[model samples]
Structures are given as C-alpha cells and as structure tokens.
Target: MEIRQLEYFVAVAEEGSFTRAAERVHVAQPGVSAQIRRLERELGHDLLDRSGRAVTVTAVGAAVLPLARAALGSVESARRTVEEMAGLVRGAVRVGMVVSCGVMDVPELLAAFHTSFPGVEITLTEANSDELVSSLVDGRLDLALIGYAGPAPDGLAVRVLADEPLVVAVTDADPWRARESVPLDELLERGVICLPPGTGLRGALDEACGTRRPRIAFEVSAPPMVITLARRGLGPAVLAASMVPPDLHAVRITDPVPSGALAFAWRAEGPHSPAARALIGLAENRVTAP
Candidate 1:
C-alpha cells in the first residue's frame, strides 16, 4: 500500500529471500520481513510463499509487481522533474540505440552533450531495435535513436533524424568489388551477411528485398562481426551507408534504392525533464543542421 512497502515487496520478489533482500536494501532481515507481512496484511492477500527456503511470488504478487514498478518509476520521474525545475541540471539520461549509431553519431553527440551539460550524466545502451523498443516501453530508456520502418509505437513521440542508405559491403577479393552499383535482384541471389531478424538493419533489408529472399550466408549479432565476416570474403554484409568500414568496398543498392530512416523516440505524455528536453533539442539540431 505504501511506497516503502512496495519497494520492500519488490526487493523480496527480486532477491527471492528476505535475508538477501534485506542486504540489498540495506535493512535488517526482520525489518524486511515485517514490512512484507504488513504489506500482505494491508492487501488481505499472501504476496509471497515462504514455505521453503527459496521464496516465490504468489499469483497476487505477480499480478501487482508490474503496477508497483510503474508506480515507483512515476515517483522517481516526478522527483527528477522537480529537481530539473530548480535549474540544477543534474540527472541521468538513459539512451537506447543501435550499433550503427555507436559508430556513426554517438561519439560526436556524447561529446557535445558533455561539453554543454557537464552536470548531466548520459548512459548509453546498444541493442537491436526490438530490445530498444522493449526498453523504451518499460521506462528503462529516456530516449532511443532507432531505425524507423513501420509505424512508431503508440503513445510515443518519434522524430525522423536522418535517412541512411543501406549499402552492401564486400571484401576486395569479391567479384562485386569492381561494380559501381549492384542490381537489387542480383544481390538477392548472392549470399548476404546479416544480423538476426530482430535487428533494425535486418528488418529494413528484409523490407527492401521484397519477394526475392536474399541468400543469407552468415547471421551475426554484432556489427563488427558482420563486417569481419564480409572482410573474410564469406559474404557481402548489409549495413547503413555510414557504417561502411574503410577496408571494405561499399556497393550501393540501386534498383529499389534500399534505405532506412533513423528516428528519436520518447514517451509522448510524460513530463519531460529539462535534461531530456535539452538532449532531444541537441539531437534534432545536430541531425538537421549541416
């Protein structure tokens, strides 16, 4: 019922033991147990099953955990918002991005942010688009620079930052290296190295290839690994135009003109903290100007 009680309950649910949860929350074991008992009493339901040494959440507990988490997150966001209103400008921004952003835009953007808002801490998480979207929905990320393919998620704001062409990179020894522009159909017949289906680049490539399924010779999760596979002459790797490594020859895909748009996304209805707003403004300015 209380925020502290919910915190204790969540800690116990996560740690699976009162003693461990107490240690994590920096409270005594008996105190933690008492809090959980009080919370269960208030709700008139048994939240945890403590029949064995390993504690487990009851059905009621499982049902309420997500709501408790959301409530706690809302509280924290409110506190941070208040702090930002005082012009303190000291808070953390969690950003979710794809690997290409790390290679192409992250360094410059981070450097500029650090210079402009030294008091603000920036945390970066790189993953496939699916993971990024999941994080964004869970309130784990403040903003995300993700590949835009289909419609944006409901109740989220999306701003298209850049449009990057998808290029086929092959090793110097490969037969396609001498070509100026490869036909989309011919490229589809040749094997292509790609990330797994959940990756943003993979989705864009799949959409672009249309009916002719490209022969995928390698499936790698890391961008560098895909580039390495291409460098080894295994197969041509599909990557954003900006991610082309210097050692590999980047061949433009022409027929259908395969390209992907990058966009920044954030929760649409929530109170925007000053630091978040500043980062969003900086991102839009950087992407739009010059």
Candidate 2:
C-alpha cells in the first residue's frame, strides 16, 4: 500500500488514540483513520480493536507494528544517506601542515580535492609538527600532514607517508662530511644547527640526545633555511635523511640514531563532513613521499 498509509497506521497504533495520532502526524483525525482503514483492508485483517477505549492493537496489528517501524526506519536512513552525499556539494574542510612538510605535496592533494568538489571551501594552517598534532587532537583540524618521530599521537588515525632516519647534513669543509655516519659524542662536540624545539626533527634529535643538551648554533624553523645555513658552513644541520640536500653529505646520526616520519593524521572517530571525507580520499592518490 502507500507509504503514507503505513505511516498513519503506525502512528495510531503507537498513540493508542486516533485524535492523538492525528496531531502527531499533523493529519486530520478522519484522514488518519481512513488511511489505517485502507491499510487494514489491503491486509484483510483488523489492525486495531476499536471496542477498547485505548485503541488496543489487534493480534494482526501487534505482529505488523514492529514490521511497520522497521520499514519507517529504513526509509529515514535512506533519506539521511542522500542528504549526507548532497552535503558534499557545499561545505568546508580545515587542514593543517607542518612547516616544510615536503614529504608529501599537500597543495597537490588539495588541488585534486578541489577539482572533485569545487564548491567545498578549504582552510590551511602552517605550524610545527607539535602544534599540528595538538590542533588535530583538539578537533580544530579535519586532517594534517606532519613530520613526527616514534609513535603517532594517541587518538589519531595515521597514514605514514615516509619513515627514515635523521641525518647530520654537513658541508664538505666540515670534518664529518667524509663520514657516512657520526657518533653522538663527535657530533655533540660543537653547536649544531637545528629546527626549533617544537618541530618533529628537533624532537627526534632531543630524544636521541637525552639529558646532554646538544649545542644549538642556529635554530631555524624552515628546513630550507636549515639547509642554507648549513651550506654556508655555520654548523652541521640535523635534518631528516630525505630532506638533506644533495650538495651536502647526509651523515646518519649514530650512537642511537633517531628516526623521523612524514604522516597524515585524522581523528580516529570522526564526525567528518562529506567534503572532508572526499578530501581524505583524494589525499591517498595525490600525496607521495619522495
């Protein structure tokens, strides 16, 4: 029969009174009664016991009640599914990235997502890895690309783009340049150029060094700047192996070498918008570690 007939029948069966069911369904009492009557006629069974003041359900109506509710639930679920997809046509997604998080091309990922969902707005934030992770945990960002060491932060779902060791990037004039790797003792003899404390590369270095503070000759946020200063022979720059310039020797740090990783993170339990979900799907294809 008609879906409306089923809806009216279910409403009356629950309310136990045609008057209350009409108010609940926003239909006139006569219309509610007529539809339920039609539904019963189709089934050739008395769906309600009108003899009772409370409008008790007939044996047939008792069995059909549960089935009618299930049908309504399925319809509502389908309607919601369509609305969620339609929502992707226009929405916004917030993204955060570490400074010089060049392990993956974030702009390229966003470009692809935009191409697919042109109406979706995107907001970008540039911060150190520590801050990016914090924003993700705080629900301020939908997704993030970051450089990190050791395990990922708790409560985030991560996709590791690249995992490699930290290195001592030194100019040829530096004595350590000739070596494939240098121990912490030799590397610590002088101040080293490094990213600021909040960065992942710096965090990795700090973890490796422990209580003995490594001398900081230069503290810069950008990896390119770290490379530029190291090229000028300021001091050895501690950087991820992948970020070391070809002009400089990438001497792996020894005496417990620290590793770094480039990764994408999102909330493990997400209230992700359709647009955000679409962007995450495109990120897998657009971002690749060198």
Candidate 3:
C-alpha cells in the first residue's frame, strides 16, 4: 500500500490500540483504522486481529512489521541525504590541530572557509599531533593539522604542508649557542625539556634516541613554554625549528636531524559531511597557494 498506510499499520502494530496508535501518529482514530483496513485489503490479509480489547498482529502482520520499519527508515535516510546535499556547508565541522602549528596558517585557512560558507560552523581544537590523529581516526575530528615523525598515520589521506628539522633551543648565555648544531646525544646530556609522550615531536625524538633514554627535565605541551624554560637554562628545549623563538639559538640536531612533518589529514573512505568537505577543499586550495 501507500507509505502513509504502512505508517499507520506499523503504528497500530506497535501501540496495540487503534486510539493510542492514532494519537501516536497524530491522526484521528477513525482515519488510522480506515488506513490500516485499506492496507490489509491491498495486501489481501487480515493484518491485525481487532476482535479483542487490545489489538494484536496476525502472522502476516508480524512478518511484515520489520520490512515496514526498514522501508520507513530507508525513506528517512534518503530524505536526510537529499537535505544534506541541498544544504551544502550547513552542519558543523570539527577540526583539530597540534598545540603548536608552525606549518599551516590555521586561522587564515579557517577565516577563508568561514567567509565562503558562513552557514558552516567551524569548531577548532588543539591537541598534540598523536592525540589529533587518534581523534581523526575515531571520527571525533573531521579534519586535522597533524605532525608526524615519519610517514603519516595509516588509514588517513594526508597532504604534506611543511617539513622542517627539529632543533634544540638555548639562550645566548648557553655554551651550545656558539655552535650552529649539536648532536642529539650532546643535547640530551645536560637535560632535555620536551613535549610529553604521544606527541609528534616526542615521537621523533624517541625514534632518534633509539634505546638510549634521554634525561627529560620537564614535559610541557606549549612550545613557547619550552623556549621559556630553555631561556632560563632549565634545559635544552627540543622543538620544531619553526617554533623556536627568534631570540633563542636554534641548534640543528646534527646526528640524524629528526624532521617534523606537518600535514592535513582526514578519513580516507568515510562519508564526509558537506561542511567537512567544504573545509577540506579550502585546505587543499591553501596548500596550492603560492
């Protein structure tokens, strides 16, 4: 029968009372009963046993109930799909970034997207690269600016934005300032202030050190804090070269300089909301910009 008739039939089957089903579907009891009767006639079966005080589904009705529900669900899903396509850039896009993003201009990129699609809401979050990658993988984040020590995280589509050497920061008073670069071992000898584990920089550092545990003086998330500590001579701060303060001497890691790779990543083969797609397009445009 018709979709409306099927809706009435399903409501009656679920509610077990014509009056209650009518109320649930916001239709008059007589109208609901008439529709169900029409549906039964069309299907050529006694769909409901209405002889008793409470209505009950017949054998045929029982078999048809699940199919009817599936039909309704499919219709609703199709309606939503059409609505989403029509309302481009209407939903929210959750974007993540590392604590210190030196490669991509997040604000500039977001501003451009917002300007193009004012209807789209851009929600920004800052976390370490590892955490950002995890969020993206779990669908908590639609897109992200993540840092990687080597290749990008698996199961994600990545566009490398920038690649730069990791450096050790020190104040002018520090003896290491005289040298242009220092070996990783020498830098770690005094004390190393680094981002905590589960971060891109720390991952790179861990990979480089390889079996040799460096003395970690302090673990902080903010790159500026690393510079602050290094300036105070608390320890040499391991940081992305771009993040090093201008006043601080940035010593390149000589023995196998660990490079920080920044990239834009998103789910490889998942359904991306219109807003998410719009933002991704903007990011791609930014990547190609001179």
Candidate 4:
C-alpha cells in the first residue's frame, strides 16, 4: 500500500531472506516484516511464503513485482527531475576505497561533500584495488579511490592522487638500510616482506620483476602491518615510498622503478548521480596530487 512497504516487498522477494533484504534497504528486519505484513493485509492475499528458510513470493507478489519496481523508478525519476530543475542535488552515492589508504585525507574530502549536500546519502566501502575496479565496472559503486600500477583499467577514468616509486623499507639493523636503492635481482636474492598479491604495490613489484620472482619472506594484508613486521627484523618490506616512516629507511627498488598510484576512478562515461559528481568535483577542488 505504502511506497516503503512496496520497497520492502520487492527487496525481500529478490533477496530471498528478510534479513538480507533488511540489510540491503538499511532497515531493521522486524520493521520490514511488519511493513510487509501490513501490505499483505491490505491486499487480502499472501505476498510471501515464510514457511521455508528462504522466502519466496506468492503468485500475487510475483505479478505485482514488476509494477512495484516501475513505480519506484518513476518516483525516483520525478524526484530527480524536480531537484534538477530547482538546482538542488540529493541522492545516494556509493563509494569504494582501497584498503591501507594513507596517501590522501579521504575523510576530509567526504566531510566537505557531506557539508555541501546534507540531504545526499553516502555509502562507503573499502576493498582492494582489483576488487574495487571490478565493482566500478559492474556499477556496484559510483566512484572509488583505488591503488593501481601500470596502465589504467578499461572503461574507467581516473584522477591521480599519488604516483610514487615503490621502495623497500628496512630498519636500521638491516644491512640494506644504508643503501640508496636496491635492484630487483638483489631484492629477490635477499628476500623481501610484501603485501599480498592483487595490491597495487605488489602489482608494481611483479611488473618490475618480470619473469623473475622475489623471495617473499612474509605476507601481510595491511601496509602498516607489513612495515611493523619488517621493523621487527622479519624482512625488508615492499611498499609505496610515502608509506615508509622517518625511523625506517626507504630504499628505492630499481632496474625499472616499481611505481604505484593512488587514484579516484569512475566509469569513463561518468557517474549517474549528481551527488557522485559533486563529491568528485569537491575532491578535485581540494586534493592536490603528489
């Protein structure tokens, strides 16, 4: 009967679980159940079969599903049209960021955008660069701050935030601490600490090493943890130059400098929502690439 109840019905039917539908709509399970119950009462028919573990829609519900979706889409389109005419931006923006992102102040950028458009909802997700790229391509996310190496992925445009050489971080106790730079061969010979595969830093390292492989002494998911393990004398760590602290020495890896980039990426065609465009625009205004 109500718009939200129809939304709940559609979500529950698609997700096959009330819990999952609740999560997808950012609502409580009980509230979703109550709304659907109220709607079913008004309709005088069971919309969903809750007898099994996975919920399934009744024949009546299946018949109404397409109509419900169309109605929701129409409402959204009308809202967007009115907002556009009034020169106001209000919508949801799904953003993804790579893990261990220390290159830029992302919080500041997000806060500024929120302050400017308080009505717009922002959902932020953290993932590795490769996963984030896939999410962007699939339209799961509107924008992403991702770390990458070599060429940009297809069907995406980027604003580079940090483009720096990947370096080996060593503690003072390590013999390589005094060195200005180390070659890929020496790094393979001595062994090195590294982030797991699929990370931008690791991608750069793999590209630089070519057919040759490095001796991976330890693998850590977090960049900070990689530095911590290396500092404890586990092994020299491979990471972005800027990630190395003053206490630890950064020895640039050469024989082709392995370079990693932190960038804000979106679809080549651009974002569907004004909120996403506004957020990226705000970031562009504030962020200065290093």
Using lDDT as the measure, name the better of candidate 1 and candidate 3. 3
How good is model 1 by TM-score? 0.62
RMSD of each: 14.4, 2.9, 7.6, 14.0
Q: For each predicted model, how many residue pairs clash, with residues at least 3 apart or on different chains?
A: 0, 0, 0, 0
Taken over the whole model, the C-alpha lDDT of each candidate is: 0.82, 0.87, 0.86, 0.86
Candidates 3 and 4, the one with greater lDDT: 4
What shift in Å separates residue 155 of candidate 4 from its native position after superposition?
0.8
For model 2, give the 10-residue run with minimal summed lDDT. Answer: 281-290
- Top-lDDT candidate index: 2
Off by over 4 Å in 4: 1-81, 85-90
How far residue 29's Cα lies from its native spot in candidate 3, in Å, is 29
Model 2 Cα displacement at 120 (Å)?
Answer: 0.7
lDDT of 4 by residue, 149-243 (tens): 88898999888988999999899899987899987778889878888887788888988888988888888888889988988988899889889
lDDT of 2 at 174: 92
Residues 1-290 of candidate 1 have per-residue lDDT tens digits of: 78888899999999898988999889999998998899899899999999998999999999988988999999999987787754426766788887756533766787898898888888999888878877877778878887756567676787776677889998889998888788888888887898888777888888887776778989988788998888888988998888888999899998887777778888877666677777877876766621
Off by over 4 Å in 2: 1-4, 11-34, 50-59, 62-67, 285-290
Task: Return the TM-score for each candidate structure.
Answer: 0.62, 0.86, 0.69, 0.70
* Candidate 3 per-residue lDDT over residues 1-290, each given as its tens digit: 78999899899999999999999999999999998889888889988999999999999999999999999999999998888766565688899998866667898898888887788878999998888888898999999998788877898998888777888888888888888989887876877899888888888888888898878989887777878888888867899887887888888897878886778999997889877887888888778521
lDDT tens digits, residues 1-290, model 2? 88888898888888899999999999999999988888889999999999978998999999998999999989999998888778777788999998877668789888878887788889999999889888988889999998777888888888889888899899999988779988988888989999998788888888888898899989987989999999999999999988887899999889899887788888888888888788777776665654
